[model samples]
Target: MASHLFVSSTRSFSCLSLILKPSPPLLGVKTLFSRSTRFPRTYKPLVRHGSNAHPKLLSALSSAPPVVAWKSSELSSARDDVVILGIETSCDDTAAAVVRGNGEILSQMVSSQADLLSRYGGVAPKMAEEAHSLVIDEVVQRALDNANLSGNDLSAVAVTIGPGLSLCLRVGVQKARKLAGRFNLPIVNVHHMEAHALVARLIERDLQFPFLALLISGGHNLLILAHELGHYLQLGTTIDDAIGEAYDKTARWLGLDMGKGGGPALEELALEGDANSINFSIPMRQHKDCNFSYAGLKTQVRVVMESKNISIENNPISSANSEDRRLRADIAASFQRVAVLHLEERCQRAIDWAIKIEPSIKHMVVSGGVASNKHVRARLRHVVETNDLQLICPPPSLCTDNGVMIAWTGIEHFLSGRFDPPPPADEPDDAMFELRPRWPLGEEYPKGKSEARSVKRARVHPSLTSMIQGSFQQQL
Candidate 1:
C-alpha cells in the first residue's frame, strides 16, 4: 500500500508499504566519496522484478567486509520500508520523486521546460540549467511530500550523476548535497544510462548480468556488459550521433513537435508506416568493432526531406501536407531500420566480445527509450533468437526516463553496500561537476584511446560464462 502525502510546504513524494517478515530490517547504505576508491567492484546493481530489493543484496553486503553503521534491512521498517529520494535533471525536465525500494512509485513530479524550449526546437543547455535552478528545490520538496515523508524519512538520496550536461548536473548535485547534509543521509551517484538498463530489473531481477545491454538514448549509444552490481563492461560506443539523436534530428527534419523529438515520435510514426516502404542500408554491418554510427542516417533524412520539398523550418509541424506525411513516415521507417541494424550489429559484437572474455552469459537484456522502439525491440528479439541470447527490455514507458528507475537503482546500490558515508553531497569530486560533452562509457583512457584498441582486444570478457562479469575491461 503506497500513497502520496505532502509536506506542509506542498512538497510531494511517495510512501512505500511492503509486506516483510517481522524482522528488524537494517538500513544498508554505502557511500563513495571519491573516484579513485580502488574497491574490487562486483555485481550489476539493479532490483529484482516485483521483489522490492534483490534477495542477493544482503548477502553481497555481508560479503563486503567493510564497516558501515547500519544495514538498511536492519534499520528499515518491519515491512521493509525503504525510501529513495531521486532527482532527474539530466536533460530539459526537472523531476523529483520519492519511491519505495520496491517497484512501487509514491509521488513523481516533472516540471517540463517544453514550452520554454519549444520555440528553439531542442533544449539549449544554459536554458535547461536555468530551468532546473528555478524548480529543482520545489520539485524535490514536492517529491518528499508526495511520499508522505521528510528528508529524515529517506534512507538514501540518489541523483543522476554522470554523462549529462555539466551545467545541469551541477545544479542538481549542488542542491541534493545540501539536502543530504541537512538529513545526514547517504548520497548515491547514479549513472543515467545504467539506470535505464536496471529499471527493468527492478520489475524483473531475474534478467541476470553477463548479458548484453544495448543502451540507446539521446547523446548515448553504448554496448554494455552487465556482469554484476557496480560492474559493467562497455563493449563499444557510438563513433558519432547516438541512435536517439539520429531519431530526434530526423524527427525535427520531418517537423515533429518540439520536446517530442525522434525517440518517442519515431515509435509512433513507425507504427503507422510501412516497414519496407523505403529500404535503407544498415550502417556498419561490416564493421568489426561494437561501435555504431547514426549521423549518416540523420543527414540522409535531411537530404531526403529537402529533395522532397518538405520544409520543417517553420512552426507547428502540422503545417506539412499529406505527401510530406507519407515521406515522413517512410523516412521514419527507413531510419528506424538503420538504427536498429546498427544496434543489432553492435549488440552481436558485444556478445562476441563477451564470449571471448566470459563464455557463460545466460542472456542479454536491453532497457532504454531506444529499446522501446518496436523496430529496435524487434531487432533485439531477432538477435536473441539467432544468437541464443536472452533479450530483455523494460516495458515501453519505463524504457524512457522516470523516477521509479532511480529508486530502483538506489535499492540495488544500498543492498550491495556500493555506497559511501552519506556526505553532504553526491560528488566528492566536486570539480567533476563540469559537463563533459564527451564521456566514454565504463572505461576512460588517456589520449592513447587509439593505441588501447589492441590492448582492449586482449581483455574482452568471456562470452558464455555461468559466473558474473565486471563492468569494463581495463587491462586491454
Candidate 2:
C-alpha cells in the first residue's frame, strides 16, 4: 500500500576540499551579515499594536558576541566549483536537483502529492509510499533531463535517509542504491534535517558554526550546532509533534486544501492577521534542555476550534470577505507568533552554548518549509538582532523540500570520501528492491557521545563530527 502511494510521493555531489594548510588555516572567509539591516516589511506592524508583554525574542541568546573572532587572513577571489545531484523523498514529494557548489542552482524538479490526498484530507503513509514507487523513476528522469545530464553525468547521488516516513524513505533509498550500483556512483546517505543545516553554506559559504540551526519541518524540530561539516550535535529535539506538523494539522483543521497545506497558506493569511488579537501563550516556558513541545500548541488549536464548535477535517475555515480574511489572518498571526516564540526560547540556550567558544555564531540559519513563513522570518530576524546572531534562511524555494539541498548534501558526502555499497540496480528483483521502514543518516556515523565509525556504508558519510568546525573548508 505504501509503495503504491510512494510512487506518487515526490520527493549531491559536493566539492572535496583537501587541506593544504595544517594549523588553524586562514582562509579568507567571506563576511556575513550580522543581521538584516532593515526590518522585513512583509507583515504589518504587529508589535506596535496594543500588547502589554513583548515577545522577549532573542534577548537571552546574546551573551557573548562575535567580537572575539577568528584570526583574520588575507584571501583571493575564488572560481573553482562543484557540480552535485540531490534527490529528496523524505516524505510525499519526489524531487531532484543539480546545484553548483558555488551556491547557484542549475536545475530542480518536484512532483507534488497534493492531488493524491485531496479527497482523503490527510496523508495515509501507504498511499504516499505507493505513489513514490510508481512515479520516482520518471521524476529522476525529469530531474536529470532538466539538468541536461544523465545519471552517468552525476559525480554522486544524495538521498534523504531518515527523519521521515519509513515507507516513503524506502522508495528513495532503494532508487538511490540502484543508481549507485549501476553507475558505481558514490552514494551519500543524507539526513533530511541536516540538509536543512548545510543549505545555508550553499548560500552563505562563510556561515560560521557553533551557531544555532533550527530545523523545523513536518517530522522534526531540532536545535543544533553545525560545529563542522558532516558533524551535528543535537542540543535539543521536539518532545511532541514537529512545528511543521502543528502547522499542517492546523491547516487541515481550517479546511485548507492539501495543495496549499498549512505552512504556505498560513503564511499568506498572516499577512492580514493581528498577532495580538488571538492570545496564545508560549509553550514549554519551563523546560530547561532546549527541548521543544509543539503538540501542546496543536492541542490548543484543536481545543479552541472545539470550543468555538468550528469544524475540523470537514468544515474548513471560511473567511469570505475582508472581515473573514481578517479572522483567518488573526488565527494565522497568533499561531505564527506562538511558533516563533517557541523556537526563539529554545534557540537561546543553543546560542548561549555556542558563545562559550566562538563568542557569537555569525549566522542563525532557519531551514525547512515552515522557515519560509514571512512572519517567522520577520520574528526570527528581530530575534537574531536582539541576540547579536545573524539570521539566515535559504530562499523560500530552497527552504522547502527540494532536490537542490539533497544534491548539495550529496556533494559534501562525496568530497568527504563517504561511500556505501549500494544495492545493484540490475540485481534480481525481489524484497531487496523493496523499501525498508528504517534508515538512519548519522546512526552509523558515530555512536554514544564521541565515538565515530571508521568503516563506511552506502548512506550518509562525511563524519558528522565535522559539524563542530568548518570541515567544508574554502579552497577559493
Candidate 3:
C-alpha cells in the first residue's frame, strides 16, 4: 500500500539443489563455495559462503533475487480478466468482498466488533484482532459464496496493509497472503484511507481525477487533492484530534449508547435538541489555514457538561427526569453544529487551494465514517454548491469501513499493473512483508506552502443555515 509501483525484476525462486565446493581451511575453518542449480544463467556472484563472511553478511544474502517463471497459459489467462477479493481488518471490523474489474461488487461480508464496544467502551486492539481472526475465514467464504465464486475464480487478492492498528491489520494481511499463495493469485496492497477516498469513484462514474477529497473518519481528518489513482497532494490535516475522535469522546461524555458508535449515536441525539440552544465556537476560526483542531472543542464540551452537572450514567436522555434529557440533547446538538462547521471551513479552503493546483477540479468527494452524518453531508453540500462544485459522497453504508471499498481500490490498482507476486507456498506463516501501520495517504504538504492562501469562507444560504440551526427547536 505504501509503495504503489510494482517492479517484477525480483521474483522468488524454488531451490532444487545446492552444490558446495570445499576450500582449504582458513583460520581453523574450512570455506565452502555454494551454487544453486536453479539460479538463473544471468545471475552473478555477489557473496560467497566463506569462513570470513560475517553473520550479518549471510543474513543479507538470504534474500537473493527470485527466479521468474510463468507458464504461457497462466500469462494469457492473467491478461484476460481480473476479479479481486479484498480483505479489510484495518480496524474494528473483519470484512471481505469480491469485486470485478468493472467496479461491480459481486459479494460483500463484514463482521463488526460491536460486542466488544459494550464491554470495553471502545476498540481494544488485541480483542479486535481476536475477533478478526475468529471470523475472517468465515467472512471470506461467505463473500465468495455470495458471489457464486471461489478462490480459483479470483484474479488477485487484496488487503489493507496499514494506517490502522497493527494487530488488526496483520489479521487481514496474513489471511489475504495465505489465500493469494494458495490460489496463486497476485496481491494488491491497499491503503485504508486511500480506499475510502477512491470508493466514491465507483459510485459516481463521472468523478474524474484531480478532484478534491475530504477524508474524515475516527482516526483521520485530511483534505487531499487526488491527482490520479495513486497520487495525492495533501492540503490539510488535523493539528490535534480528528473530528471523529472529538465526536466519539463527546458522545461518551454525553452518555450516548455505544452500540452504534459515538458518531452515529451523537448524530441521532443531536436531532432531539435545538442546535442553537448551546453555542460551541468553531475550531480554528482565527487561523485561515486549512488545518483542523478538535481537541479544544472536545475540551469545551467536557467543561460545559461539568458546569451543567450533566449526568452521563446510563443514557441520561432516557432517564426519568425530563430536564436532564433536554440538557444532554442540547450538548449533543451544539457539539455537532461546531464539529460540522470546522469541516465546512477547511473544505472551503481546500477547494480554493485545490482549484489553483488543478483548475479542472469540479467535484469534492467526501468519504470515511464521519461523512455518513446527515448534518455533515448537508453542510458540505452547501459548501460545494457555493463554490460551483458538485459534492460526491458514497452511501452511508459505504462511508463506513467495509470490504467493498478495499476491493474497489484493489481493482483500480490491479488495472494499473500495481501488484506483487503471490507469496511462495513454502513461505513461513510469520514471514515479514511490507505492512505499514502508519502510512500516509500521499506526500505531505509541500515545503514552504504550509498554509494555503486565504479564501473567503463560502456563504451558506441563510434559509439553509437557519433551517439547520432550528432543526432541533421543533423537537423541543
lDDT of each: 0.62, 0.62, 0.72
Encode model 1's per-residue lDDT on 282-357: one tens digit a residue: 7766556777777777776777777777775762347766766777788777777767877777777677777667
TM-score of each: 0.74, 0.73, 0.77
Query: Which of the two candidates, 2 or 3, achieves a greater TM-score against the reference?
Result: 3
Model 2, 1-476: lDDT tens per residue?
Answer: 22222121111322321111112322332221211111111111111111221122111111212121222221111112335667788787878777654456767777777766565665678888888888888788767666566655554678887657778888887777777667655566777877888888788877765566888877777767665555566666666578888887777776665566667877776767788887787887755556667877888777776775566645655644565556656777788788889888777766776566456567788998888877778877886778887888999878888888888877665433343444455765444532323332232211112122122234433433432233334322
- Please provide, for model 3 over 1-476, each residue's C-alpha lDDT reduced to its tens digit, 9 standing for 90 to 100: 01011111111111111111222211211111111111101111133223333333233223222322335454333323456888999988888887765566777787778768656767789988888888888888888777777776676788998778889999899889888887666777888888999999889988988799999998889888887766677788776689988888888778777777889999998988988888888887877777878888998898898889775555534553777777888889999988898899888888888888899998999999999999999999999999999999999878988888999888776544345666776668889976677666666555213343332224312221122224324323
Name the candidate, 2 or 3, with the larger lDDT value: 3
User: What stretches of model 2 exceed 4 Å from their correct place?
Assistant: 1-82, 101-104, 318-329, 421-425, 431-476
Please list the Cα RMSD from the true structure of every candidate, rounded to 1 decimal place. 8.9, 14.9, 16.1
User: Which candidate leads the pack in TM-score?
Assistant: 3
Please give the lDDT score at residue 8 for candidate 3: 11
| lDDT for model 3 | 0.72
Give stretches of model 3 more than 4 Å off. Answer: 1-80, 313-316, 447-476
Per-residue error for 186 in candidate 1, Å, reads 1.8
Stronger candidate by lDDT (1 vs 3):
3
